[model samples]
Target: MGLLWGITLLWAFSFSLIGVYLAGQVDAYLAVASRMALALLVFLPFWRPLPWRQALVLMATGAIEIGIMYLFLYKSYQYLTVAELLLFTIFTPLYVSLFADLFARRWPKHLWAPALLAVAGAAVIRWTELSEDYWKGFALIQAANACFAFGQVWYRHQSKSTSLTHRARFAWFFLGALLVTALASALLADWQKLPVTPVQQGVLLWLGVVASGLGYLGWSYGSTLVSAQQLAVMNNMLIPAGIVVNVVIWQGQVDWLRLGLGSVCMAGALWLCRRQSS
Candidate 1:
């Protein structure tokens, strides 16, 4: 729980930073590749050999979750506002709950209500006029969300021996992500649009090392400590947290009434989940 909360705060600025600094100026594929490469490097020193099967699984998880997920996320910034992007991610909790139930081969039965409530709350937050690009961006973000949710649940449930710690094994995860992103960048990115400004380079470094590296480590570890229901509810925590960061740093205008009301609903949903667990 502490890990989740800490990462929530750390990640609060990530959306705004990407939207403001990297989205339009940097080639999305290149950005993704660079970020993953740096993160891979961060974990490489601690890397240990794992079974071929386990290594492959972690690699696939990273490719889908971080590699492809970032592909959708970065492209969506061209079409949607940061607020809309965050709002669309409200459905992630539902995806998380569904995937967890599927992977477990039995429904928890207690997760549905809270997950639905969280979705409803998120809908309320963005119930205003939308641009024509809404549906496209919405679909893209949903794909990213589903992949991310699946990865988190899958990693959380994996059985491992107590030999090497998770940190020691995480390099394979980022290595897989790097392969996907690097390939994508090589094939799709505009070489002419690489980061040139010092600020751009610095932001990329920060995102790769701090956000992708440490943030993922904390988030994945945190998922193991909480119930699936709690994890589902906590997935929505980023919406409000990101919004607060956007408003404070970028001075983005937000609907306070809607934000307050939606936050109440989400809070209520989280409370319900906690009560059920108790």
Candidate 2:
């Protein structure tokens, strides 16, 4: 849990950095590719060939989990503010719980009520001012959430069956993610919008080396140390941490009433899920 909390703190500033420094300013694919490449480098020294089957599974998980997830996540900043982005991510825990159950082939009948509550929470945010751009961003976030949730569930299960230490096999994960992002950058990145400013370059370096490389390794290892219920709760912890970082550090304004109400609804969902799981 300490490791997870530390990674959460490390990641708290990630959304704001991307929103302020990379998103819309730098090409999303290029930024994602750069981050993945640098992150991959961190684990490259530990690389050893896993069984082909294990390698493929880990690779596939990385592609969906971080690679494609980042694509959606980075693109989201074009439409959503840091506050709105953080608020919408409140649904992630619910997705995590749902996906875990699905992979286990068990349906928890009680999950539906909390799921609806979570959706209501999202609806409560800016419901009066819905627009195409807002909905697009929301959809992109949900997609990223699903990818991340699925990957967490997958890795937690997959890691248990593997014999290699986390450091020994984790590079395969980043290698998989790198392939996806690198291909996307080659095909779709905007060459004209590369990172130019020192701040942009520095942010990318920090995000790649520390926040992503180390943070994800810590998170994946920590996920193996805790209960699914605990993991679900920890996933949501990033919300308040991120919102506070965005608000206090960046002076990002949030619609307090809406944020409060939405947060209550989302919190209720988490509580209900926790109660059900327990």
TM-score of each candidate structure, all chains considered together: 0.93, 0.84
Q: Local distance difference test, per candidate?
A: 0.86, 0.81
| Residue-level lDDT for 47 in candidate 1 | 92
- Supply the TM-score for candidate 2: 0.84
lDDT of each residue in 1-278, candidate 2, tens digit only:
78988998889899789878877798888888898899999999999977799899989988999999988887787888755676577678678778877877887566556666766776565355344468888899999998998899899988777788888667989899999999889988889999999999999999999988998889988988875656666676675566668888999876778768867876786677677767
lDDT of 1 at 129: 66
Model 2: lowest-lDDT 10 consecutive positions: 123-132
Off by over 4 Å in 2: 75-88, 109-128, 132-139, 255-278
Compute the lDDT of residue 216 as modeled in candidate 2: 89
Error of 1 at 94 (Å): 0.7
- Model 1 ranges with Cα > 4 A deviation: 77-83, 133-136, 159-163
